[model samples]
Target: MTRETSEQPPEIAEVLARWQETWPTALQLWNPYVSLREPQWCLTTAEAREAGLQDSFAMIRLRGLAVVVDLETVRKLRVENYALQVLAHEIGHHLLVPANLYDYAGLMMRVRLALAGIEDRAPLVANLYADLLINDRLQRTMGQDMASLYRHLREKGIGETRIFLWYMRIYELLWSLPRGFLSCDKSEPVLDADASLGASVLRSFARDWLDGAGRFAMLAYPYLIEDALHQQALREFAHLSDITSAGVGAELPAGMAEIPSSVFDGIVDPREEVLQNAPNHQEADSPGRAKPGSLTAIIPGSDASTGPQQRYMQPGIYVDLMRQIHPDVDEDRLIGRYYRDVVTPHLVPFPVEALGELSGDVLPEGTDPWEPGDPIEDLDWFESALLSPIVIPGVTTRRRVYAEDIAEPEKEKPYHLYVGIDCSGSMHNPRRTFSWPVCAGALVSLSALRVGARVMACLSGEPGSFMETRGFIKEENEVLRVLTSYLGTGYAFGIPRLETEHLQNAKEKTHLLIVTDDDIFSMLAAPRSDGQTNYDIAEQALRRAGGGGTLVLHARAEWRPQEAERLRQMGWVIHYVTDENALFDFAKAFANRFYRSQGNPTCKRP
Candidate 1:
């Protein structure tokens, strides 16, 4: 198992070769795509560093679809079952623990939540939980002597913290061993009765691990809540896991994504749900964002008579989880997801059943009976046949007749929705993969489409590529596709791009919505091809379209006074917020004011 060669050492390699031959027999499935490689073969020490691997050889990292292993280290430790057991554990991680990128993110989300106050060691604690689940599976189902691996690991054990000891005790209980099975102190393990219960509970829910995770974390909450305990634990285990190396070692393999995000939607903090469903639970006034002192995580399925609620999980918990899952999750996108998830239930989808926005030409789907005054063309013949028994002198199904309002005379007003979003580098959250502006843009675009309005979604990142839907169309999917895509090249939103590409070509009076930061000043400052400034182009577009507009800027008060004032003079609505999060509020308010109560998509002022 020595990592001395680019090739696997003959001695350890032989053991693994034998195991590899029978690996498929055990897994009962063949995956030609997976292969084994030595540490140097899979990735050089340098490559490992680049992938953020810890310096320790005790850890293995999966990267580039291959698991990186230092066989020599494994051989030295004389692990139980050698490559067979250890390799299986790593493969299990790929097969189950993470499953996909979103689940991988879910892994961190659940762990950080479970660790709450002792989040500094969240990754470490998470690794322990994962190992427990994996080992228990192998020992219970696969019939492997996985406990032997821990026996050797504990022999070199340095120190014990309450949480760590409690963690180990669960292992002891799982294996039917005494409490002091793997402790360095050499004294009888002073164990929490909860550990025995946790071990029992762990087995009880092994088949359904994700949901059980939230519950297990609740049990471990008291053991990890204090810094005094954490410090003492750190001091006790200094030789075991260095605090600095904890994060790096705890990292999963590079390129560990094959799963879609939709799979993790059901993954939630069980405690949060319990708290949410509490009999006395009261939602914060501003449900769009985390309000101060508004968050609490009660014990899942806790008895009401058990003293006061064991509450935790304060504000910013989700933000912390997001940041931890990946350093690059877009802040605005998270904000958008949060607001969208929160406000979506509150939003009554546009009253599509009501033919309120119907053009006087024809009727839409329905089975409502026609009255004597109903138009003959609006009668539902099929519905009338279905209800033939109730036939009467002018009784037939007809869509409730409603007259559409016109924004302007001489035109059949179908509201034109123009969304101009800043797709510049600033809109990109390197930590996260998606754009929030795109999400927010999607919400509004979808709303407009639901109400029979044409949506023109434009992604403008000045001095770079600009994308827009083909003028305005009613297809919701097409509109959503354009809004959620990202263009991370430009420096700011291109006002000229909007003028030349969107506003100038608008076929009808359009409700133009621009999403950008104060940096839009620079885009406005950029010169245009025709001698006209970007501002002039923007102003003229509003005038030409003759539809009221809104500039939703994530900028400071000092940043917007002049341009916001200028845009206001041009009959544009200026809504400023200190952060992108408030865009959701603006969106909800705008939808309520302009689209919700409307009888039709007409180019008329509210």
Candidate 2:
């Protein structure tokens, strides 16, 4: 895409000429197997912007494993001669801190937790922490002239905001440079003290960089709390910022919805640590630290201990974290993934099918000319001899083909699943909070899919529009998208959803499972749009399905006696879960009862 342009000056041309040879050396600094494509050489600033290297002379795009450099901006920043330092730093982004897309999202997740109310400053804080880790390793161990490169940038009259000064002060402390060498002599004792702590954190968590992310962000929080100071830092550090858009246009990373329990241990504030360890305060009597069991010391965003099933971040917090990482992420797809991640750990094992012995009689059907590649066992020498007394290879070839009159094996397949969830105004939104009904539906449906069963998931609310899969399908995401969605329109699950075309024409036995509350009995007694009542429709649906049906209610068993008995008389097994969390237990039992195995005498075929 590069073309000739008068915008390219002689100095820019000179930097481009030598930068090609610098890539291999940058790669070697990491390891011998560290490989990357050649960096995009944008001859002018316009070309650099087009390549998405905006506001920085060099940047890396994690989506394509691409490195982009603007020779013009490199010269403008007056660091054209330090190609190895710049290229290796960009390479360091790929090799180390926030290495892949998942770790990048992880880094953002931790940083967001630390910066609670000031979350818009996450990208800036994350980028700074990443740069510190990469540049520290390069300068201290790899023997790259990273300090000289930074000194040049400092000499460029970059405004020394508190954040910038504090940032540079940490570098000065890390490298043992004189106080004014990188950070000008404007440093105060508070800045020096924080810088000391920052340097200590960098060294301690160098190998486990993601663990250090929260601490570093906590250190940078106060510096960036004010909007004006953050804007100044952005303007001053624009040329050095490389990872601000690292996750743009990249696929969303999985497993980020659940934060590991150990992550909270690394979120200690450096300032708080210093106060707790000071000699004047007695260790046991110190008030600097939070009480042992309190969540006050934990990062403010999510508490893993509070979830009903497996520990997970809040849905709204997860959505916010993802949006910060990828601005254009679709909220619908993101919310679906959040609940899918939450319910994954609670799903049952895939159902196993029993194998019966083959019972078939082999009988000769007809003879055909055998090709040279045909199996020799199938050749009929007598038939070939009848065709010709003297055998010519291709001319006298004959083979007897056999057909098998095989009786079908006794092995049973898993029943297809028809899962209906109530999405009424009473039900909590799964996107904003945890919804046990949605979780139960996902757990059972995904387990069904794992066992080679098709699933038709429906979300219904009475007296309002309903959402469902196009039909019974095998796609997990489509099924989840329907379950995780909220209708919030009507009172209870629409019983007429049982009259869908897929259910009416099902060829195989299907387990009909509906999750609702006591209100469903009210809906069941209500009449349908047609002349028949919903009770008649429910009975017909059970008959058409041919498999036993189950209604899982989030209410006490004694709540609806007459209606429950009528449905029970129609061959629907009523499972009552008084607590919402009990729904997962019901799902596990239901799957085991219906889909576990064919030979298990304890479970009857649905």
Ten contiguous residues with the weakest lDDT in model 2: 286-295
Task: Compose the digit string of candidate 2's lDDT tens values, residues 1-606.
Answer: 111224433575677888888889989999999889999999989998988788899988898898889898887766767889899999999989788999998888788877767788998889999999999999988998788888878877985898788889999999988888888888987778778888999999999999998888878877887789888888988988899888878999888888787777777677777766787954443222222323363543434323453467778778888887788889888988887787677665554444444457788888989778888888889999999988776779899988776554445567899999999999999888877788788888987887778999999987887999999999998999999898997999999999899999999989899999889988888865678998999999999998879898888877879889999999999988888888877877777666554442123465
Maximum-TM-score candidate = 2
For candidate 2, give the lDDT of residue 409: 48
Candidate No. with top lDDT: 2
Pull out the clashing pairs in model 2: none
RMSD of 1: 14.6
In order, what lDDT does every prediction score?
A: 0.56, 0.82
What TM-score against the true fold does each predicted structure earn? 0.51, 0.85
- In candidate 1, stretches whose alpha carbon ends up further than 4 angstroms from where it belongs are 1-52, 55-66, 184-190, 222-319, 327-442, 445-509, 514-541, 550-606
